[model samples]
Target: MRRAAQGMLATIALALLTAPSSLARVYLTQDQALALAFPAPASVQRRTLYLDAAQAARAGREAGGAVETRVVPYYVGTAEGRPVGYAYFDTHLVRTLPETIMVLLAADGRIRRIDILSFDEPEDYKPTERWLQQFPGRGPGDELSLNGGIHALTGATLSARAVTQAARRVVALHRLFVAPFPPPSGPAPGKGDGAPPGAPGAVRP
Candidate 1:
């Protein structure tokens, strides 16, 4: 009987070893996500913002979550010598794994689009496109929490919370850093334009 029990354990281990893994997946790259967020833009420029301690604290309070970093990177899209939109990428853990998403905002500070760049969780936990549609046109003042204005997913509670928090954080960051100062009109500065790095007009290489 002991030998039979040992054989059963070995069989169980073998079955576990042969089972498929739900590992990480790269659904889109930065370039692809940018294209989708800002279709047909004349130019796309990258910029960063460095928040002071006070600013960071206010941002965290506004977002209802911790602001993990003081250094933030955002993108600006332009067309016909006018600002078009801004985009921010946020990556956070869903359950025990990570998921990266891009939150694109219209010039008026409303959420324009959201795209999942990568996910390191089971596919079942990933939110569907239909569910994600609720984010667009939402702004900093909108209720983005689950069951507030956004509906909850049946089985993906962690994912839903992470995404909702990300959206709120990005919008709060935009209101604090980007909305107050609009990018200068006309073509964005090229390399060596002499704008200090992390300044409003600074461009990312």
Candidate 2:
């Protein structure tokens, strides 16, 4: 009986080690989470993003630290077989706990929404849904920081920062790897906006 109990204990321990740590006790599964972002999508494309040494360095630069995972599971949400948006959950180390945050990007690669999949930190450390709302519609070049643009949490600075950094990394990755992005086309040549270079009928000396 003792031997059998020991074997069961060993099996449990092994499962814990091999399972995903970010999704620790989370209520939402991958499909459900994706559905929240995209309702009735035609299909979800699954891909894996691999970062080489140089790529890792660049991603780290954007993240302001080493990314928690090198290999990321990427999902493309499509409708009618046309790509609508991109999404992927990344594990960010919030102090001691690695929290899973699912970032959704628009077709233009801007952050559409952020969902906190799982976090084991204290309740006080959890950023409220309103606080989380501040992330949507923010682009890669936007200055995303705790005190800079985003409101700072009272005592959850680390958690806030971790989430912010993760957002930046996702945007950076989109620009770096995700492709066929067109340059920001300006107004037609010889056509200017905003007062048309001067008032239409302004008196000139």
Candidate 3:
């Protein structure tokens, strides 16, 4: 009888341990961001950031130096009429700024591909993971007010704000630069642009 009780308790504990946390949320990818908000054709290339130090330095100047940035690739795919998925750079924004920033190229205003150039944050970052999910359907057009969309946690407001700001910055950059240019034939992305080093078959497009 005691053994049976122990077994039941163990089973319950296991279930609790594996259960999905209620606070967990999900975010979109680089390709998705473009689909939701297409940049002008002229601004597409300006969205990308190469991994070389010189380029990083240039980006620093552009972003007001001292802020690291990672370049993420967004491919926008479309369906019949309305927008579908919205993609953004998949790298952690607040934690990995300056190290990686995302660039988006959209087709039919939907995201179809994603490339994450830098992910300085630990892969298992728990606090910020839930917050990233809040950005998928939002854009500058959303006219997001502070304290809108997702609520910030009591202890993690700073991280949440960083994410929101980062998303806003990305959207603003695309709108400012890429929204005006005509669509050019997107070239096959090469190494060091956003591809993870030594990862075979890891192209964004």
Q: Estimate each model's TM-score.
A: 0.78, 0.73, 0.36
lDDT of 1 by residue, 54-168 (tens): 7678779989999887778888888997878998999888887789999999989899888899988889999889899999989967888999999998899999999999999
Against the true structure, candidate 2 reaches a TM-score of 0.73
Q: What lDDT score belongs to each candidate, Candidate 1 first?
A: 0.81, 0.71, 0.42
Clashing pairs in 1: none
Ranking by lDDT: 1, 2, 3
Itemize residue pairs with steric clashes in candidate 2: none
Worst 10 residues of 1 by lDDT: 182-191
Candidate 2 yields a Cα-based lDDT of 0.71
Is 1 or 3 the stronger prediction by TM-score?
1
- Per-residue CA lDDT of model 2 for 1-205, tens digit only, reads 9999999999999887656553465756778889887888357777666555666676577656675555666788889767788887877678876788899998888889988888866667877788888998898678787788788877888888889888888887665555335224432211232323223211111
Which residue runs of candidate 1 sit more than 4 Å off their true CA positions? 1-23, 181-205
Q: Residue 179 CA error for candidate 3 (Å)?
A: 2.6
User: Which candidate ranks first by lDDT, i.e. highest?
Assistant: 1
